[model samples]
Target: MTQSASPPNRALLELPQVQRERLSHIDFKLYFLGELRRTDVADRFGTGPAAATRDIAQYKELAPENLVLDNTDKIYRPTANFVPLFDHAPQRVLTALSRGFGEGIGEELKPMVRCEFPMALSEPKMSILAPITRAIHRNKAVRVSYTSIESGRSEREIVPIALVNNGIRWHVRAYDRRRKGFRDFVFTRMENPVLLEDSPITDEEKVDQDVQWNRIIELELVPHPAHPRPEVVMMDYGMPDGVLSVKVRAANAGYMLRRSAIDCSPDHSLSGPEYALWLKDPLALYGANNAQLAPGYRNPRDDSENKPIKAL
Candidate 1:
């Protein structure tokens, strides 16, 4: 759950979707990102060379123009006039690299220079998300024992709509049948989701009416004024003209702000090591557009007696 840990795109492809993800990943990193090694294929799918070889051949058979074998390197290189068969998303590529390094897929960690990354304190199990995914795809309702800072642990019936990444944590946007309102449920907080056989989506539970989830809001960020070297800070953020405009869904703005540690306080002095960036316009995050979610900025659980779902 490195914020980017999504279940592999399996269902959209043809039959034998079990291996669709492995095949797609091999081709994706090969043609779009870099060369694909059989070691990559083996490590990714936890399969031996024989199976990995078959997957590679299957991918080539489907999209023969994409990858060329480099015998000397024993790797598949992206070919000229290569076109991707499976769709690629930039975030997915970055996350795969992060997870690969974390799992030491192709490299031994001890030999590489170690760098600090914000470790995930809580990551929801894939077992929990799979049922939620099935429920959403089928537009069905589910039952789960959810532990929230607001309601604490309770059994509830929910019509799951979408699985969302609020930059740092994964959340499910669902219409609570009990509450009769939409709420964002942290994936980690859920337990034993049971997809109901007969539950159906109600008109009140439609995602289209969830304005905050759909509305996009832009926030301009600049290096904190307290930073001694603004020029260096500018280079760090790659800000052009001393400003970086970030467009994110209103519902997810709080997460980006909290993730970046951008101070939105009125007296927004840098608080700690995390607060290197500050919001240029505090109101953009706190004003009307993002009001419902952004007010509970950093410490969301503390203020959630009146809000739906705590801060990611």
Candidate 2:
């Protein structure tokens, strides 16, 4: 539901695609960046002042409560009652925030803003990605030539339920027929993907069957016990109570922990410079198939009683 949502300004749907896209851009700038100038719209769309004014006027007509014009600053600031007229994906917004926009738009056009962060290390080929994504959208299976670290290259049919970005790379969370279970297939390693339109997914292959993906677990992270300045770590992570709690799917818990360099060891044994936080309850990761991916993670049951840990 978060991936896509109905636009509040249903009237905007009646407009042509080109105009609607421009209006959406305006709405994005206002909602995310707090202020948007008329020239910002003009520069992004390569339009003149007159055309930009007309677009703004149309947006004002559509959602008068959304923005307020500041004559002194010549910027449109978001009003308190502002509700997004367009649904913006979190991934797209984060990309724009971190890398700036102007993605394939043009070199002449300026980026949304200056941004600095680690860029994507890999991207999947569109030829293979398209059909796989189409399969997910259509609720069907896909035939793919996949290469895995453990098994090497193999041809397989998979029922893809969702696409996951584990921070560093992309994955298709699918039901692997050969394995008789759900697994995450790296996108870049998949080749020659073909959508099997005739293959109707059975109840067993649906997302409901994937316990790790459906189950949510809350992780409690605190400053590394050995850290010299625990207060600084708390401030940095906005942990007023010296604890940062996050709820994530069991399928993604390991990736989240690894991505943030949180020490997942029960004893807080990780001494690396990258580790700023430690998982307060290593037992919280019980039943998480991907927990092995977490740095220094050890199953608490490996040394003690193997009882089911209560879900948070």
Alpha carbon lDDT of each predicted model: 0.71, 0.85
**Winning candidate number (TM-score):** 2
- For 28-129, candidate 1 gives per-residue lDDT tens digits of 676545588887788766889999898888888776777888899788888766766666677665555544433453445321123346777777798999
Q: For every model shown, what is its TM-score relative to the native structure?
A: 0.63, 0.74
The 10 consecutive residues of candidate 2 with the worst lDDT sum are: 303-312
Off by over 4 Å in 2: 1-39, 42-94, 98-110, 303-312
Indicate the worst ten consecutive residues by lDDT in candidate 1. 1-10
RMSD of 1: 8.5
Collision count for each candidate, in order = 0, 0
| TM-score of structure candidate 1 | 0.63
**Tens digit of lDDT per residue, candidate 2, span 135-231?**
8888999999998877789999999999998889888899999989999889889888988878878999999999999999999999999998999
Model 2 TM-score, all chains together:
0.74
C-alpha positional error of residue 219 in candidate 1 after TM-score superposition, expressed in Å = 0.6
